[model samples]
Target: MKRREALEKKKSIEELIKNANDPLKDHLNSLPCSYRHYNRNGLSVYLESGIGSNLSSFKKQYIQKLLKVNMEAAYGPKEWVFEEKVKRKEMVAPDARYVFVREIVDNEDGMQPPGDSFVGFLQYRFVLEEEMPVAYVYELQLEQCVQGKGLGKFLMQLVERIAYEYRMSAVMLTVQKGNVFAMDFYVSQLRFVVSSNSPSRMGFNTSYEILYKAVDCEAKEK
Candidate 1:
């Protein structure tokens, strides 16, 4: 009964945060504005944050295409189903938040750059998971051109910081067993562990596993 009450309190906390006009603003204010700009490995890019519903049509299409391509490559065409996996409603749900990485383009004329400049994006939401408040990563997709430049780790670290600031218990995400690179990145490099609620642990023969990193010491102990 005490555990149930605690879980309810956590859910309420998450709802309050998600209902804010700018959920990430307070958590991000302490960071320098330049933190959004990435310049390394001869690659320059900028980051922007917004709720999924705010994504422009161009950006929406870009995200769908990028996610489709990446998932297909990982799962193969035989396992890929567009409607089942790439649902637009889920991607653009009001509660879904995004951190977009766009290439830096020079326009001395002071006009917006032509065409899409997006290179990658991370989508996440604050929710109750395993009776704990958690930041759940729905997707992290990057263009092939920008892969292996440490951007993925940088983005995830940002997510962890934000989650910590928001008092979330942990950062959680799902990874497909077929995506060996991603599994290694999360498990080996980032040190995320398989969650106790993962399908494999529950005796379910699923193709994917749920992994998480505890953000709070209390959560780690639990």
Candidate 2:
């Protein structure tokens, strides 16, 4: 009986080791890092820090401004921005696109989604004042210093995987047509198709193009 008990303990320890070796499990064990809960005032503050003199170009310029700030801060630590003082000129008119933090949840169909379960981070969405599918991510940011650590791609994949699980036709966003880095990243790396002839929305005249990735692809082996 003592021998059997020792074997059971060994088995439990082996199971733990196996779980610890999993990449996702390892990340979760190490995470909840660099997350913030930005409310309206907080979101406003976060945006103001990045973009100056917000104009009402787009209906929800505030949300777009936030995305711009988050993106720039995450990826834009160049000398030219400071030297040329181009940061001030980058501000857009304030509009109604807002951000929120709800929760990250795995759907019944086995897709992980943020903002549905309680992850305590900001999620920016562009929604018309009168629309049903109001939750649309214009741009997603995972903090500046932590950008290249694979977490950004992981979070995006999480969103894509969840959207696919729910049978979403496509996931969409507008990109600054001149943002070659963003265009290349989405179009080449992630396989999103660019819409060549989409109608431009009001006040969003800064070289915008609609891009989308199909969510319903054949399941790949895990």
Candidate 3:
């Protein structure tokens, strides 16, 4: 409990990212250096770490746009309004952390690319679930162009790796039941199971389901 509390109180997850020997860092380094593009040799895609509170205005807008584009349908009109407001508040929370997938132009000058280069992002935070320390993924939004390319799976894998590195009990996320693709991807492909704290498990009817992948059994036991 003490260890979990300490981790929850941490201001940043950068220590793990900066550790030279951390497997999470190694895994990130092993991703494809370039994504194939039509004109250039290849567009470079890289992961960047950020805190929600520190996000630039442009990035904040981009995140909002991505969330709306990807989730509005699943949430529907009535629910979307409330959900959007909630998500906007969550996005700027002090503890929220992000892993952004960004594309770089294949140019000699290495200038900042246009907003379209922002492919996707994963937002998460450390929290206690059922008295156990866990990493809760609030959002994982990918652009349509990047869909079906295994990037979502890769991001989830990174989340699990991060959880293991931090000795978290599990990596948890919520998915709307209406989103069949997301449901299949997480439950079937990623092997996430319905969490005990989920509304369904508790005999409640809800639009979303909570799912989790246990990362450290020993940590959970402790």
Candidate 4:
């Protein structure tokens, strides 16, 4: 896309997001069905989204298992896994307005329960931090069975589009330093830069890197 066209497109999407009924509502409308399917390494994988507050107990359990399985190698302590979910339950409440993503598998006829075949999830929120609004990614995880198939990139593109549409100048996330693949994926493929205030840059030398990709020139480096 040309620079001028891209800027106009972002402006148009921003207007839609600002005028829509809910926060960034047009972004979801653009998606229509909460579900979409794509081919990954010849396997059809479905990605779906919904109001986080609407997730059922079973769905929550599915998220728990997927997160534990996908992240335990990097995060450690299965008990912390459970604890994190406990805190997440608070995040998914209605007013927090989180958008949740889950991967579903299709049956022979393409019909299945929403909670039955969940392979993973991504949780996100749009809000002002330090006086700047940004699309903050809380979590993005996929089952080991279907990972490394470009699905993460697919989902991230969706997130970036939404961020741009919502007029957020930056798309921000945190990556564990131990997760080398994730680091390379964000920095190399997605072109994310480490924020000036990131843990390592600030001398905390933490295990996490706060990364962001500027959607426009006005985006803060931090």
- Model 1, residue 108: distance off in Å is 2.6
lDDT of 2: 0.40
Count of clashes, each model: 0, 19, 0, 0
Best by TM-score: 1
Candidate with best lDDT: 1
- What residue runs in model 3 are displaced by over 4 Å at the alpha carbon? 1-44, 110-116, 218-222
* Cα lDDT, all candidates: 0.82, 0.40, 0.75, 0.68
Q: Is candidate 1 or candidate 4 better by TM-score?
A: 1
TM-score of 2: 0.39
Task: Report the error of model 4 at residue 147, Å.
Answer: 0.7
Per residue, candidate 1 scores C-alpha lDDT tens digits across 76-157 of 7766675436557778887788888888877986534345788999988888787777889999999999999999998999
As a whole number from 0 to 100, the lDDT of residue 34 in candidate 1 is: 64
Error of 2 at 156 (Å): 1.6
lDDT of 4 at 172: 85
For model 1 the local lDDT of residue 91 reads: 85
Ranking by TM-score: 1, 3, 4, 2
Q: Which lDDT tens digits does candidate 2 get at residues 108-165?
A: 8653333222221223222321111112344454444334544444445544543343
So what's the TM-score on candidate 4? Answer: 0.76
Pairs that collide, model 4: none
lDDT of 1: 0.82
lDDT of 3 at 181: 90
**Candidate 2 lDDT score at position 43:** 28
